[model samples]
Target: MMLASSCRRFYADGSLAPWGVLLAILDIWALVNIFGKPWDLSKKLIWAAIVFFFPFGGLILYYLFGRNSS
Candidate 1:
């Protein structure tokens, strides 16, 4: 009964959390810059800013301030 209940609970939530996905993406981005290839200066600066001020405001700030249209 316990095993069945646990199985049902696990399957009840079939969606991945956005925050976890975002963190994973961020980890990959950091890993790429650290272990794979160096990023351009401007892009690196933007990434630093995003990591420094995390959660949501940093994203808004990056989109508004750091992103270059060209």
Candidate 2:
């Protein structure tokens, strides 16, 4: 509910849809990579929760800290 409403506001008559789409794609990519990492299940779950709950910021955090982190 809140997510949809916030996305609608972001669209701004569809002009911002591409940015949303890119973020969604990045989130998916992040999830897939997190799952594939050799880290423990608990660590993966923690990172997954972060990326799931906060998309853009999470992506940044993942790339900055999660990536290359075993």
Candidate 3:
């Protein structure tokens, strides 16, 4: 309930701009990659590429293109 209210407040307040939200999410993604379960070399390399080259853009792309669940 608290989490849900906070998320509602977030959208209502507009304190979190889209880019800022994207940055926060990307930062979390990088952290998750660093700490989460181990992956195969290729998968780790892919995540490293996303984390290093253009973490923000990569995250935005993932959100837009890869996260559309039906």
lDDT scores for all predictions? 0.46, 0.79, 0.51
Ranking by lDDT: 2, 3, 1
Worst lDDT run of 10 residues, candidate 2, spans 1-10
Highest-lDDT candidate: 2
Off by over 4 Å in 2: 1-9, 12-16
TM-score of 1: 0.33
Model 1: CA > 4 A from native: 1-16, 23-47
TM-scores for every candidate against the unseen true structure: 0.33, 0.80, 0.37
Tens-digit lDDT string for candidate 1 (1-70): 2112212223337654555556446544543443333556676765665544462445445456544433
In the predicted model 1, the residue pairs found to clash are: none
TM-score of 3: 0.37
- What would the C-alpha RMSD of candidate 2 be, to one decimal place? 3.1
lDDT for 1 in candidate 3 is 23
Residue 17 of model 2 has an lDDT of 71
lDDT, model 3, position 31: 42
Per-residue lDDT tens digits for candidate 2, residues 1-59, read 21343344365565657667677778889999999999999999999988888887788
- In the order shown, the candidates' Cα RMSDs to the true structure are 10.6, 3.1, 9.8
